[model samples]
Target: MKRKLIAMLMAGVTAVTLTACGGSGETSTEGSAANAEGDKNYKIAVLMSHQTNAFTTAVSSGAKDKGTELGVTVDILDGKQDPNTQASQIETCIAQGYDAVLVEPISADAIVPAVKAANEAEMPVMTIVQQMKNQEDMAVSYCGGDESKAGKMQMEKAMEAIGGKGNIVVLYGPMGSDAQLSRKAGYDEVLKNYPDVKIAFEDTANWTTEEALSKMETWIQTGTQIDAVVAQNDSMALGALKACEDAGKDIPCFGLDAVDDALAAIKAGRLAGTVSQDAYGQGAIGVENMVKYLNGEEIEPFNYTECIWIDQSNVDEYIDK
Candidate 1:
Protein backbone atom coordinates (compact mmCIF):
# COMPACT_ATOMS: atom_id res chain seq x y z
CA MET A 1 0.00 0.00 0.00
CA LYS A 2 2.82 2.39 0.85
CA ARG A 3 4.62 1.62 -2.40
CA LYS A 4 1.44 2.23 -4.44
CA LEU A 5 0.70 5.52 -2.69
CA ILE A 6 4.31 6.63 -3.33
CA ALA A 7 4.02 5.77 -6.99
CA MET A 8 0.76 7.71 -7.33
CA LEU A 9 2.15 10.75 -5.62
CA MET A 10 5.31 10.71 -7.73
CA ALA A 11 3.44 10.21 -10.97
CA GLY A 12 1.12 13.12 -10.27
CA VAL A 13 3.86 15.46 -9.11
CA THR A 14 6.12 14.62 -12.07
CA ALA A 15 3.35 15.39 -14.53
CA VAL A 16 2.47 18.65 -12.78
CA THR A 17 6.12 19.71 -12.67
CA LEU A 18 6.34 19.61 -16.45
CA THR A 19 3.11 21.56 -16.94
CA ALA A 20 4.06 24.08 -14.27
CA CYS A 21 7.46 24.92 -15.78
CA GLY A 22 6.57 24.77 -19.53
CA GLY A 23 2.88 25.03 -20.37
CA SER A 24 1.53 28.19 -22.04
CA GLY A 25 -2.13 28.07 -21.04
CA GLU A 26 -1.36 27.01 -17.50
CA THR A 27 -0.91 29.72 -14.90
CA SER A 28 0.74 29.17 -11.54
CA THR A 29 -1.54 29.99 -8.60
CA GLU A 30 1.42 30.50 -6.27
CA GLY A 31 5.16 30.92 -6.54
CA SER A 32 6.88 27.56 -7.03
CA ALA A 33 3.53 25.98 -6.25
CA ALA A 34 4.32 22.53 -7.59
CA ASN A 35 7.97 22.30 -6.54
CA ALA A 36 8.14 24.51 -3.47
CA GLU A 37 5.45 22.48 -1.74
CA GLY A 38 8.45 20.27 -0.74
CA ASP A 39 9.54 16.96 -2.30
CA LYS A 40 6.07 15.67 -1.40
CA ASN A 41 4.39 13.70 -4.19
CA TYR A 42 0.88 14.66 -5.42
CA LYS A 43 -1.94 12.14 -4.95
CA ILE A 44 -5.77 12.01 -5.02
CA ALA A 45 -7.66 9.86 -2.54
CA VAL A 46 -11.26 8.96 -3.44
CA LEU A 47 -13.63 7.74 -0.75
CA MET A 48 -16.85 6.17 -2.00
CA SER A 49 -19.74 5.93 0.44
CA HIS A 50 -20.90 2.61 -0.97
CA GLN A 51 -20.44 0.25 -3.95
CA THR A 52 -23.50 -1.98 -4.00
CA ASN A 53 -24.51 -1.00 -7.54
CA ALA A 54 -23.28 -0.51 -11.09
CA PHE A 55 -23.43 3.28 -10.77
CA THR A 56 -20.57 3.41 -8.25
CA THR A 57 -18.54 0.96 -10.34
CA ALA A 58 -18.86 3.25 -13.34
CA VAL A 59 -17.92 6.27 -11.26
CA SER A 60 -14.78 4.59 -9.89
CA SER A 61 -13.86 3.47 -13.41
CA GLY A 62 -14.16 6.97 -14.80
CA ALA A 63 -11.95 8.54 -12.15
CA LYS A 64 -9.25 5.87 -12.39
CA ASP A 65 -9.23 6.02 -16.17
CA LYS A 66 -8.81 9.78 -16.17
CA GLY A 67 -6.12 9.52 -13.50
CA THR A 68 -4.18 7.19 -15.77
CA GLU A 69 -4.67 9.42 -18.80
CA LEU A 70 -3.12 12.37 -16.98
CA GLY A 71 -0.42 10.41 -15.09
CA VAL A 72 -1.97 10.94 -11.66
CA THR A 73 -2.32 8.51 -8.80
CA VAL A 74 -5.84 7.73 -7.60
CA ASP A 75 -6.30 5.91 -4.29
CA ILE A 76 -9.85 4.73 -3.75
CA LEU A 77 -11.52 3.71 -0.47
CA ASP A 78 -14.94 2.19 0.14
CA GLY A 79 -17.01 3.40 3.08
CA LYS A 80 -19.66 0.68 2.72
CA GLN A 81 -22.59 2.98 3.57
CA ASP A 82 -21.20 3.89 6.95
CA PRO A 83 -20.56 7.54 7.73
CA ASN A 84 -18.15 6.66 10.52
CA THR A 85 -16.16 4.49 8.14
CA GLN A 86 -16.02 7.24 5.56
CA ALA A 87 -14.96 9.82 8.10
CA SER A 88 -12.22 7.50 9.37
CA GLN A 89 -10.99 6.90 5.83
CA ILE A 90 -10.75 10.62 5.17
CA GLU A 91 -8.61 11.01 8.24
CA THR A 92 -6.35 8.23 6.99
CA CYS A 93 -5.90 10.09 3.72
CA ILE A 94 -5.02 13.24 5.59
CA ALA A 95 -2.57 11.35 7.79
CA GLN A 96 -0.88 9.97 4.71
CA GLY A 97 -0.48 13.51 3.41
CA TYR A 98 -2.25 13.22 0.09
CA ASP A 99 -2.26 16.32 -2.09
CA ALA A 100 -6.00 16.26 -2.64
CA VAL A 101 -8.96 14.03 -1.79
CA LEU A 102 -12.27 13.21 -3.49
CA VAL A 103 -15.30 11.91 -1.62
CA GLU A 104 -18.77 10.45 -2.23
CA PRO A 105 -20.01 10.73 1.33
CA ILE A 106 -22.75 8.57 2.85
CA SER A 107 -24.84 11.58 3.84
CA ALA A 108 -24.85 15.37 3.80
CA ASP A 109 -23.87 15.68 7.47
CA ALA A 110 -21.92 12.62 8.63
CA ILE A 111 -18.83 13.34 6.53
CA VAL A 112 -18.41 17.05 7.13
CA PRO A 113 -15.88 17.08 9.95
CA ALA A 114 -13.55 14.66 8.25
CA VAL A 115 -13.61 16.94 5.22
CA LYS A 116 -13.20 19.93 7.51
CA ALA A 117 -10.11 18.35 9.03
CA ALA A 118 -8.55 17.81 5.61
CA ASN A 119 -9.13 21.45 4.68
CA GLU A 120 -7.69 22.60 8.00
CA ALA A 121 -4.58 20.60 7.20
CA GLU A 122 -4.43 22.48 3.88
CA MET A 123 -5.36 19.44 1.78
CA PRO A 124 -8.14 20.21 -0.69
CA VAL A 125 -11.14 17.88 -0.49
CA MET A 126 -13.93 17.64 -3.08
CA THR A 127 -17.14 15.67 -3.48
CA ILE A 128 -18.97 13.74 -6.17
CA VAL A 129 -22.66 12.51 -6.46
CA GLN A 130 -23.46 12.75 -2.70
CA GLN A 131 -22.89 16.27 -1.48
CA MET A 132 -21.64 17.50 1.90
CA LYS A 133 -23.46 19.78 4.32
CA ASN A 134 -21.91 23.04 5.65
CA GLN A 135 -19.50 23.06 2.71
CA GLU A 136 -18.91 26.77 2.50
CA ASP A 137 -15.24 27.23 3.45
CA MET A 138 -14.30 23.66 4.35
CA ALA A 139 -14.62 21.67 1.11
CA VAL A 140 -13.19 22.80 -2.19
CA SER A 141 -15.74 21.73 -4.85
CA TYR A 142 -18.55 19.38 -5.89
CA CYS A 143 -19.54 17.52 -9.09
CA GLY A 144 -22.79 15.62 -9.34
CA GLY A 145 -26.36 15.58 -10.69
CA ASP A 146 -29.00 18.16 -9.93
CA GLU A 147 -30.77 16.13 -7.22
CA SER A 148 -34.00 18.14 -7.24
CA LYS A 149 -34.24 18.06 -11.00
CA ALA A 150 -33.67 14.32 -11.19
CA GLY A 151 -36.37 13.70 -8.61
CA LYS A 152 -38.79 16.04 -10.33
CA MET A 153 -38.26 14.26 -13.63
CA GLN A 154 -38.97 10.82 -12.15
CA MET A 155 -42.14 12.01 -10.34
CA GLU A 156 -43.41 13.74 -13.45
CA LYS A 157 -43.24 10.52 -15.48
CA ALA A 158 -44.85 8.52 -12.68
CA MET A 159 -47.66 11.07 -12.38
CA GLU A 160 -48.38 10.75 -16.10
CA ALA A 161 -48.44 6.96 -15.82
CA ILE A 162 -50.98 7.23 -12.97
CA GLY A 163 -53.15 9.68 -14.98
CA GLY A 164 -52.17 12.83 -13.05
CA LYS A 165 -53.67 11.92 -9.65
CA GLY A 166 -53.17 8.79 -7.57
CA ASN A 167 -51.52 7.36 -4.50
CA ILE A 168 -47.77 7.06 -5.21
CA VAL A 169 -45.35 4.99 -3.17
CA VAL A 170 -41.99 6.68 -2.65
CA LEU A 171 -38.87 4.59 -2.01
CA TYR A 172 -36.22 7.00 -0.84
CA GLY A 173 -32.50 6.45 -0.31
CA PRO A 174 -30.82 6.75 3.10
CA MET A 175 -32.28 9.50 5.21
CA GLY A 176 -30.24 12.74 5.27
CA SER A 177 -28.18 11.76 2.26
CA ASP A 178 -27.91 14.64 -0.18
CA ALA A 179 -29.63 12.87 -3.07
CA GLN A 180 -32.42 11.46 -0.93
CA LEU A 181 -33.32 14.83 0.55
CA SER A 182 -32.86 16.93 -2.58
CA ARG A 183 -34.89 14.58 -4.78
CA LYS A 184 -37.73 14.46 -2.24
CA ALA A 185 -37.76 18.25 -2.30
CA GLY A 186 -38.31 18.12 -6.04
CA TYR A 187 -41.14 15.61 -5.68
CA ASP A 188 -42.84 17.90 -3.17
CA GLU A 189 -42.51 20.89 -5.51
CA VAL A 190 -44.30 19.13 -8.38
CA LEU A 191 -46.95 17.47 -6.19
CA LYS A 192 -48.30 20.88 -5.20
CA ASN A 193 -49.49 21.53 -8.73
CA TYR A 194 -51.75 18.50 -8.60
CA PRO A 195 -53.47 18.56 -5.23
CA ASP A 196 -55.10 15.19 -5.74
CA VAL A 197 -51.78 13.32 -6.05
CA LYS A 198 -50.92 11.75 -2.71
CA ILE A 199 -47.91 10.02 -1.28
CA ALA A 200 -49.42 6.80 -0.03
CA PHE A 201 -46.22 5.45 1.51
CA GLU A 202 -42.73 6.94 1.89
CA ASP A 203 -39.78 5.34 3.64
CA THR A 204 -36.01 4.90 3.52
CA ALA A 205 -34.37 1.58 2.76
CA ASN A 206 -30.89 2.93 3.36
CA TRP A 207 -30.45 2.24 -0.41
CA THR A 208 -30.64 -1.54 -0.51
CA THR A 209 -32.68 -3.63 -2.94
CA GLU A 210 -33.60 -6.25 -0.36
CA GLU A 211 -35.07 -3.68 2.04
CA ALA A 212 -37.09 -2.03 -0.67
CA LEU A 213 -38.40 -5.38 -1.86
CA SER A 214 -39.40 -6.32 1.68
CA LYS A 215 -41.13 -2.99 2.31
CA MET A 216 -42.92 -3.16 -1.02
CA GLU A 217 -44.08 -6.70 -0.40
CA THR A 218 -45.51 -5.71 2.97
CA TRP A 219 -47.30 -2.78 1.36
CA ILE A 220 -48.81 -5.09 -1.28
CA GLN A 221 -50.03 -7.50 1.41
CA THR A 222 -51.84 -4.65 3.16
CA GLY A 223 -54.22 -4.25 0.19
CA THR A 224 -53.41 -0.57 -0.04
CA GLN A 225 -54.27 1.03 -3.39
CA ILE A 226 -51.03 2.26 -4.89
CA ASP A 227 -51.01 3.60 -8.45
CA ALA A 228 -47.25 3.99 -8.95
CA VAL A 229 -43.80 3.71 -7.36
CA VAL A 230 -41.38 6.62 -7.45
CA ALA A 231 -37.93 5.71 -6.22
CA GLN A 232 -35.00 8.03 -5.69
CA ASN A 233 -32.65 5.59 -7.41
CA ASP A 234 -32.84 2.63 -9.83
CA SER A 235 -32.04 -0.08 -7.27
CA MET A 236 -35.14 0.70 -5.24
CA ALA A 237 -37.32 0.88 -8.33
CA LEU A 238 -36.21 -2.57 -9.45
CA GLY A 239 -36.91 -3.87 -5.96
CA ALA A 240 -40.40 -2.39 -6.11
CA LEU A 241 -40.88 -4.04 -9.49
CA LYS A 242 -39.88 -7.39 -8.05
CA ALA A 243 -42.45 -7.04 -5.28
CA CYS A 244 -45.18 -6.10 -7.72
CA GLU A 245 -44.22 -9.04 -9.91
CA ASP A 246 -44.31 -11.49 -7.02
CA ALA A 247 -47.75 -10.25 -6.04
CA GLY A 248 -48.95 -10.78 -9.63
CA LYS A 249 -49.68 -7.11 -10.06
CA ASP A 250 -48.47 -4.42 -12.45
CA ILE A 251 -47.56 -0.94 -11.34
CA PRO A 252 -45.75 1.88 -13.11
CA CYS A 253 -42.37 2.59 -11.50
CA PHE A 254 -40.15 5.63 -12.06
CA GLY A 255 -36.59 5.88 -10.79
CA LEU A 256 -33.39 7.88 -10.94
CA ASP A 257 -29.87 6.73 -12.00
CA ALA A 258 -30.29 4.97 -15.37
CA VAL A 259 -28.13 1.95 -14.64
CA ASP A 260 -27.98 -0.96 -17.09
CA ASP A 261 -30.69 -2.89 -15.27
CA ALA A 262 -33.01 0.11 -15.27
CA LEU A 263 -32.45 0.60 -18.99
CA ALA A 264 -33.12 -3.09 -19.65
CA ALA A 265 -36.27 -2.94 -17.50
CA ILE A 266 -37.53 0.01 -19.50
CA LYS A 267 -36.75 -1.80 -22.77
CA ALA A 268 -38.70 -4.83 -21.53
CA GLY A 269 -41.65 -2.53 -20.70
CA ARG A 270 -41.45 -3.29 -17.00
CA LEU A 271 -40.42 0.16 -15.78
CA ALA A 272 -41.88 3.54 -16.63
CA GLY A 273 -38.55 5.46 -16.91
CA THR A 274 -35.36 6.63 -15.12
CA VAL A 275 -33.07 9.63 -14.98
CA SER A 276 -29.37 9.29 -15.75
CA GLN A 277 -26.88 11.35 -13.75
CA ASP A 278 -23.91 10.15 -15.85
CA ALA A 279 -22.02 8.33 -13.12
CA TYR A 280 -18.92 7.97 -15.27
CA GLY A 281 -18.68 11.67 -16.06
CA GLN A 282 -19.19 12.62 -12.42
CA GLY A 283 -16.07 10.74 -11.31
CA ALA A 284 -13.93 11.46 -14.37
CA ILE A 285 -14.57 15.20 -14.54
CA GLY A 286 -14.49 15.66 -10.77
CA VAL A 287 -10.99 14.24 -10.54
CA GLU A 288 -9.82 15.91 -13.75
CA ASN A 289 -10.71 19.30 -12.32
CA MET A 290 -9.21 18.45 -8.92
CA VAL A 291 -5.90 17.66 -10.61
CA LYS A 292 -6.07 20.88 -12.62
CA TYR A 293 -6.87 22.96 -9.55
CA LEU A 294 -3.96 21.43 -7.65
CA ASN A 295 -1.80 22.32 -10.65
CA GLY A 296 -2.65 25.99 -10.14
CA GLU A 297 -5.73 26.18 -12.37
CA GLU A 298 -9.13 27.65 -11.49
CA ILE A 299 -12.26 25.49 -11.19
CA GLU A 300 -15.91 25.82 -10.22
CA PRO A 301 -16.93 25.29 -6.61
CA PHE A 302 -20.12 23.43 -7.61
CA ASN A 303 -19.92 21.48 -10.86
CA TYR A 304 -23.36 19.97 -11.45
CA THR A 305 -23.35 17.64 -14.45
CA GLU A 306 -26.14 17.32 -16.98
CA CYS A 307 -28.68 14.48 -16.62
CA ILE A 308 -30.64 12.61 -19.32
CA TRP A 309 -34.10 11.05 -19.26
CA ILE A 310 -34.49 7.49 -20.61
CA ASP A 311 -37.62 5.51 -21.41
CA GLN A 312 -38.80 2.95 -23.96
CA SER A 313 -38.83 5.62 -26.67
CA ASN A 314 -35.10 6.29 -26.22
CA VAL A 315 -33.72 3.38 -24.21
CA ASP A 316 -31.99 1.76 -27.20
CA GLU A 317 -29.66 4.71 -27.77
CA TYR A 318 -28.32 4.30 -24.17
CA ILE A 319 -28.42 0.57 -23.32
CA ASP A 320 -25.04 -0.63 -24.65
CA LYS A 321 -23.16 2.44 -23.57
Candidate 2:
Protein backbone atom coordinates (compact mmCIF):
# COMPACT_ATOMS: atom_id res chain seq x y z
CA MET A 1 0.00 0.00 0.00
CA LYS A 2 2.83 2.39 0.87
CA ARG A 3 4.65 1.36 -2.27
CA LYS A 4 1.57 2.08 -4.34
CA LEU A 5 1.18 5.52 -2.78
CA ILE A 6 4.85 6.29 -3.36
CA ALA A 7 4.66 5.22 -7.00
CA MET A 8 1.66 7.44 -7.51
CA LEU A 9 3.42 10.35 -5.84
CA MET A 10 6.38 9.94 -8.18
CA ALA A 11 4.38 9.47 -11.35
CA GLY A 12 1.65 12.04 -10.77
CA VAL A 13 2.89 15.04 -8.81
CA THR A 14 6.11 16.98 -8.58
CA ALA A 15 5.17 18.79 -5.39
CA VAL A 16 6.58 17.31 -2.21
CA THR A 17 7.24 18.35 1.37
CA LEU A 18 10.50 17.02 2.86
CA THR A 19 10.68 17.82 6.56
CA ALA A 20 13.10 15.46 8.29
CA CYS A 21 16.47 16.80 9.30
CA GLY A 22 18.27 13.50 8.77
CA GLY A 23 21.64 14.51 10.13
CA SER A 24 24.00 17.39 10.76
CA GLY A 25 23.66 18.94 7.30
CA GLU A 26 26.86 20.23 5.70
CA THR A 27 27.76 22.48 2.81
CA SER A 28 28.25 21.12 -0.68
CA THR A 29 31.69 20.39 -2.12
CA GLU A 30 32.81 22.34 -5.19
CA GLY A 31 35.04 20.70 -7.76
CA SER A 32 38.37 22.22 -8.75
CA ALA A 33 38.15 21.63 -12.47
CA ALA A 34 39.48 24.19 -14.91
CA ASN A 35 40.15 23.28 -18.50
CA ALA A 36 43.15 24.53 -20.48
CA GLU A 37 40.93 26.87 -22.46
CA GLY A 38 38.97 27.64 -19.27
CA ASP A 39 35.88 26.12 -20.88
CA LYS A 40 34.66 22.81 -19.52
CA ASN A 41 32.65 20.84 -22.05
CA TYR A 42 31.23 18.47 -19.49
CA LYS A 43 29.39 19.90 -16.52
CA ILE A 44 27.92 17.66 -13.85
CA ALA A 45 25.90 18.34 -10.76
CA VAL A 46 26.36 16.07 -7.75
CA LEU A 47 23.71 16.47 -5.10
CA MET A 48 24.34 15.01 -1.65
CA SER A 49 21.73 14.30 1.02
CA HIS A 50 23.88 16.16 3.57
CA GLN A 51 27.54 16.74 4.46
CA THR A 52 27.37 17.29 8.22
CA ASN A 53 28.68 13.81 9.05
CA ALA A 54 31.75 11.77 8.24
CA PHE A 55 30.02 9.33 5.92
CA THR A 56 28.46 12.03 3.72
CA THR A 57 31.65 14.08 3.76
CA ALA A 58 33.71 11.10 2.59
CA VAL A 59 31.28 10.50 -0.22
CA SER A 60 31.19 14.18 -1.22
CA SER A 61 34.96 14.38 -1.02
CA GLY A 62 35.44 11.27 -3.14
CA ALA A 63 32.98 12.48 -5.76
CA LYS A 64 34.50 15.97 -5.96
CA ASP A 65 38.07 14.62 -6.19
CA LYS A 66 37.13 12.14 -8.91
CA GLY A 67 35.10 14.70 -10.84
CA THR A 68 38.05 17.09 -10.82
CA GLU A 69 40.44 14.31 -11.81
CA LEU A 70 38.17 13.44 -14.73
CA GLY A 71 38.22 17.07 -15.91
CA VAL A 72 34.48 17.40 -15.50
CA THR A 73 33.17 20.59 -14.03
CA VAL A 74 31.21 19.42 -11.03
CA ASP A 75 28.85 21.53 -8.98
CA ILE A 76 27.99 19.71 -5.77
CA LEU A 77 24.86 20.71 -3.90
CA ASP A 78 23.84 19.87 -0.38
CA GLY A 79 20.13 19.05 -0.12
CA LYS A 80 20.14 19.89 3.62
CA GLN A 81 17.92 16.88 4.33
CA ASP A 82 14.99 18.42 2.53
CA PRO A 83 13.36 16.71 -0.47
CA ASN A 84 11.93 20.00 -1.69
CA THR A 85 15.39 21.50 -1.68
CA GLN A 86 16.67 18.47 -3.54
CA ALA A 87 13.91 18.74 -6.12
CA SER A 88 14.58 22.43 -6.60
CA GLN A 89 18.32 21.75 -6.92
CA ILE A 90 17.71 19.12 -9.55
CA GLU A 91 15.36 21.46 -11.38
CA THR A 92 18.09 24.07 -11.29
CA CYS A 93 20.59 21.56 -12.63
CA ILE A 94 18.31 20.71 -15.52
CA ALA A 95 17.79 24.37 -16.32
CA GLN A 96 21.55 24.97 -16.20
CA GLY A 97 21.98 22.24 -18.83
CA TYR A 98 24.41 20.06 -16.96
CA ASP A 99 25.80 17.09 -18.81
CA ALA A 100 24.73 14.79 -15.99
CA VAL A 101 23.24 14.90 -12.51
CA LEU A 102 23.93 12.65 -9.54
CA VAL A 103 21.71 12.75 -6.50
CA GLU A 104 21.98 11.23 -3.02
CA PRO A 105 18.34 11.51 -2.20
CA ILE A 106 17.05 12.76 1.18
CA SER A 107 13.87 10.77 0.60
CA ALA A 108 13.42 8.32 -2.23
CA ASP A 109 9.70 8.94 -2.79
CA ALA A 110 10.01 12.70 -2.70
CA ILE A 111 13.06 12.78 -4.97
CA VAL A 112 11.28 10.84 -7.69
CA PRO A 113 9.92 13.89 -9.49
CA ALA A 114 13.41 15.35 -9.65
CA VAL A 115 14.89 12.20 -11.13
CA LYS A 116 11.96 11.85 -13.49
CA ALA A 117 12.44 15.42 -14.57
CA ALA A 118 16.05 14.63 -15.44
CA ASN A 119 14.88 11.68 -17.51
CA GLU A 120 12.34 13.84 -19.29
CA ALA A 121 14.99 16.40 -20.12
CA GLU A 122 17.14 13.65 -21.66
CA MET A 123 19.88 14.34 -19.15
CA PRO A 124 21.64 11.38 -17.60
CA VAL A 125 20.90 10.84 -13.92
CA MET A 126 22.96 8.76 -11.50
CA THR A 127 22.30 7.92 -7.86
CA ILE A 128 24.75 7.57 -5.06
CA VAL A 129 24.45 6.11 -1.52
CA GLN A 130 20.73 5.23 -1.71
CA GLN A 131 18.33 4.04 -4.40
CA MET A 132 15.15 5.92 -5.13
CA LYS A 133 11.92 4.26 -3.95
CA ASN A 134 9.89 4.48 -7.19
CA GLN A 135 10.81 5.25 -10.82
CA GLU A 136 14.25 3.65 -10.36
CA ASP A 137 14.23 2.84 -14.06
CA MET A 138 14.95 6.49 -14.82
CA ALA A 139 18.38 6.27 -13.21
CA VAL A 140 21.37 5.38 -15.35
CA SER A 141 23.33 3.85 -12.46
CA TYR A 142 23.50 3.41 -8.66
CA CYS A 143 26.62 3.12 -6.50
CA GLY A 144 26.15 2.27 -2.84
CA GLY A 145 26.27 -0.43 -0.19
CA ASP A 146 23.92 -3.40 -0.43
CA GLU A 147 21.23 -2.10 1.93
CA SER A 148 19.55 -5.45 2.50
CA LYS A 149 22.77 -7.15 3.52
CA ALA A 150 23.92 -4.26 5.69
CA GLY A 151 21.29 -4.84 8.34
CA LYS A 152 21.68 -8.62 8.20
CA MET A 153 25.38 -8.38 8.96
CA GLN A 154 24.84 -5.94 11.80
CA MET A 155 22.10 -8.04 13.36
CA GLU A 156 24.06 -11.23 12.88
CA LYS A 157 27.06 -9.82 14.68
CA ALA A 158 24.88 -8.33 17.35
CA MET A 159 23.14 -11.62 17.91
CA GLU A 160 26.50 -13.31 18.29
CA ALA A 161 27.63 -10.83 20.94
CA ILE A 162 24.32 -10.86 22.78
CA GLY A 163 23.80 -14.67 22.67
CA GLY A 164 20.51 -14.11 20.79
CA LYS A 165 18.42 -13.39 23.87
CA GLY A 166 18.07 -9.84 25.12
CA ASN A 167 15.81 -6.85 24.99
CA ILE A 168 17.18 -4.18 22.68
CA VAL A 169 16.35 -0.70 21.52
CA VAL A 170 16.75 0.36 17.93
CA LEU A 171 17.70 3.81 16.74
CA TYR A 172 16.91 4.42 13.11
CA GLY A 173 17.33 6.97 10.37
CA PRO A 174 14.45 8.74 8.65
CA MET A 175 11.61 6.25 8.34
CA GLY A 176 11.20 6.40 4.56
CA SER A 177 14.86 6.69 3.70
CA ASP A 178 16.37 3.68 1.98
CA ALA A 179 18.82 2.83 4.77
CA GLN A 180 16.21 3.03 7.52
CA LEU A 181 13.72 0.83 5.70
CA SER A 182 16.22 -1.72 4.43
CA ARG A 183 18.02 -1.96 7.77
CA LYS A 184 14.75 -2.60 9.57
CA ALA A 185 13.89 -5.36 7.13
CA GLY A 186 17.23 -6.97 7.90
CA TYR A 187 16.61 -6.65 11.61
CA ASP A 188 13.26 -8.38 11.28
CA GLU A 189 14.77 -11.10 9.15
CA VAL A 190 17.27 -11.93 11.86
CA LEU A 191 14.89 -11.38 14.77
CA LYS A 192 12.54 -14.02 13.42
CA ASN A 193 15.17 -16.65 14.25
CA TYR A 194 15.43 -15.52 17.88
CA PRO A 195 12.09 -15.75 19.58
CA ASP A 196 13.32 -14.73 23.04
CA VAL A 197 15.11 -11.69 21.68
CA LYS A 198 12.81 -8.69 21.41
CA ILE A 199 12.98 -5.17 20.16
CA ALA A 200 11.75 -3.38 23.27
CA PHE A 201 11.79 0.09 21.72
CA GLU A 202 12.23 1.38 18.23
CA ASP A 203 12.22 4.93 16.97
CA THR A 204 13.69 7.29 14.40
CA ALA A 205 16.10 10.01 15.43
CA ASN A 206 16.37 11.26 11.88
CA TRP A 207 19.93 9.87 11.75
CA THR A 208 21.27 12.67 13.93
CA THR A 209 23.55 12.05 16.91
CA GLU A 210 22.00 14.79 19.01
CA GLU A 211 18.49 13.50 18.45
CA ALA A 212 19.51 9.93 19.13
CA LEU A 213 21.19 11.06 22.33
CA SER A 214 18.02 12.79 23.41
CA LYS A 215 15.97 9.71 22.63
CA MET A 216 18.39 7.48 24.53
CA GLU A 217 18.47 9.86 27.48
CA THR A 218 14.70 9.83 27.63
CA TRP A 219 14.65 6.07 27.45
CA ILE A 220 17.13 5.93 30.31
CA GLN A 221 15.06 8.32 32.39
CA THR A 222 12.04 6.07 31.86
CA GLY A 223 14.13 3.16 33.19
CA THR A 224 13.73 1.10 30.06
CA GLN A 225 15.53 -2.17 30.62
CA ILE A 226 17.63 -2.51 27.49
CA ASP A 227 20.43 -5.04 27.09
CA ALA A 228 21.66 -3.79 23.74
CA VAL A 229 21.26 -0.96 21.25
CA VAL A 230 21.00 -1.54 17.53
CA ALA A 231 21.39 1.69 15.68
CA GLN A 232 20.98 1.89 11.93
CA ASN A 233 23.97 4.20 11.50
CA ASP A 234 27.14 5.21 13.32
CA SER A 235 26.07 8.71 14.18
CA MET A 236 22.97 7.50 15.98
CA ALA A 237 24.84 4.66 17.60
CA LEU A 238 27.46 7.04 18.93
CA GLY A 239 24.72 9.15 20.37
CA ALA A 240 23.24 6.12 22.02
CA LEU A 241 26.61 5.26 23.41
CA LYS A 242 26.99 8.76 24.76
CA ALA A 243 23.67 8.53 26.55
CA CYS A 244 24.56 5.16 28.01
CA GLU A 245 27.91 6.52 29.08
CA ASP A 246 26.30 9.46 30.82
CA ALA A 247 24.04 7.13 32.74
CA GLY A 248 27.03 4.83 33.39
CA LYS A 249 25.21 2.01 31.70
CA ASP A 250 27.53 -0.24 29.76
CA ILE A 251 25.62 -2.24 27.20
CA PRO A 252 26.54 -3.83 23.89
CA CYS A 253 25.72 -1.50 21.00
CA PHE A 254 25.93 -2.13 17.26
CA GLY A 255 25.77 0.24 14.34
CA LEU A 256 26.24 0.38 10.58
CA ASP A 257 28.10 2.83 8.25
CA ALA A 258 31.47 2.24 10.05
CA VAL A 259 32.17 5.97 10.03
CA ASP A 260 35.41 7.37 11.47
CA ASP A 261 34.06 7.63 15.00
CA ALA A 262 32.58 4.19 14.83
CA LEU A 263 36.04 2.77 14.28
CA ALA A 264 37.38 4.77 17.19
CA ALA A 265 34.47 3.73 19.35
CA ILE A 266 35.02 0.08 18.59
CA LYS A 267 38.71 0.42 19.42
CA ALA A 268 37.81 2.05 22.71
CA GLY A 269 35.25 -0.69 23.37
CA ARG A 270 32.36 1.75 23.25
CA LEU A 271 30.53 -0.27 20.58
CA ALA A 272 30.13 -3.97 19.97
CA GLY A 273 30.24 -3.88 16.17
CA THR A 274 29.58 -1.90 12.99
CA VAL A 275 29.13 -2.62 9.30
CA SER A 276 30.90 -0.67 6.62
CA GLN A 277 29.03 1.30 3.93
CA ASP A 278 32.22 2.16 2.04
CA ALA A 279 31.38 5.81 1.48
CA TYR A 280 34.59 6.61 -0.36
CA GLY A 281 34.35 3.55 -2.56
CA GLN A 282 30.76 4.27 -3.52
CA GLY A 283 31.42 7.91 -4.35
CA ALA A 284 34.47 7.11 -6.46
CA ILE A 285 32.72 4.33 -8.31
CA GLY A 286 29.66 6.48 -8.96
CA VAL A 287 31.79 9.12 -10.62
CA GLU A 288 33.64 6.48 -12.63
CA ASN A 289 30.37 5.08 -13.93
CA MET A 290 29.15 8.58 -14.78
CA VAL A 291 32.28 9.15 -16.82
CA LYS A 292 31.82 5.81 -18.54
CA TYR A 293 28.25 6.68 -19.48
CA LEU A 294 29.40 10.01 -20.95
CA ASN A 295 32.03 8.15 -22.97
CA GLY A 296 29.33 6.01 -24.60
CA GLU A 297 29.96 2.97 -22.45
CA GLU A 298 27.14 0.96 -21.04
CA ILE A 299 26.94 0.32 -17.29
CA GLU A 300 24.96 -2.00 -15.08
CA PRO A 301 21.81 -0.88 -13.31
CA PHE A 302 23.23 -1.75 -9.88
CA ASN A 303 26.87 -1.36 -8.89
CA TYR A 304 26.88 -2.57 -5.32
CA THR A 305 30.00 -2.42 -3.22
CA GLU A 306 30.76 -4.88 -0.44
CA CYS A 307 30.55 -4.28 3.36
CA ILE A 308 32.47 -5.84 6.23
CA TRP A 309 31.21 -6.47 9.73
CA ILE A 310 33.72 -4.78 12.01
CA ASP A 311 34.16 -6.03 15.53
CA GLN A 312 36.88 -6.29 18.19
CA SER A 313 38.68 -9.05 16.32
CA ASN A 314 39.04 -6.87 13.22
CA VAL A 315 38.64 -3.39 14.66
CA ASP A 316 42.40 -3.08 14.51
CA GLU A 317 42.22 -3.61 10.77
CA TYR A 318 40.28 -0.37 10.38
CA ILE A 319 41.69 1.70 13.24
CA ASP A 320 45.28 2.87 13.11
CA LYS A 321 47.79 1.40 15.54
Query: TM-score per candidate, in order?
Result: 0.87, 0.87
Q: In candidate 1, list every pair of residues with a backbone clash.
A: none
- Listing every candidate in turn, what is its Cα RMSD in Å to the true structure after a full C-alpha superposition? 8.7, 9.6
Q: 234-314, model 2: which lDDT tens digit per residue?
A: 999999999999999988888888887898888888888899877877776787688788877788889998878888788
| Model 1 lDDT at residue 169 | 92
Would you list the C-alpha lDDT of every candidate in the order shown? Answer: 0.78, 0.78
Write down the TM-score for model 1.
0.87
Model 1 lDDT per residue over 1-321, tens place: 001122432243222222221113221111123332244335777777777788887777666656655656666677778888788878877787778888897978878788888888999988899788886567788988999988888888777888788888999898888988999999988898888888889899777788989999999999989999998888999999999999998898887888889889999999989998888878878877898788787889899877788999989888874
Give the per-residue Cα lDDT of candidate 2 at 179: 80
In candidate 2, which residue pairs clash?
A: none
**Model 1 ranges with Cα > 4 A deviation:** 1-41
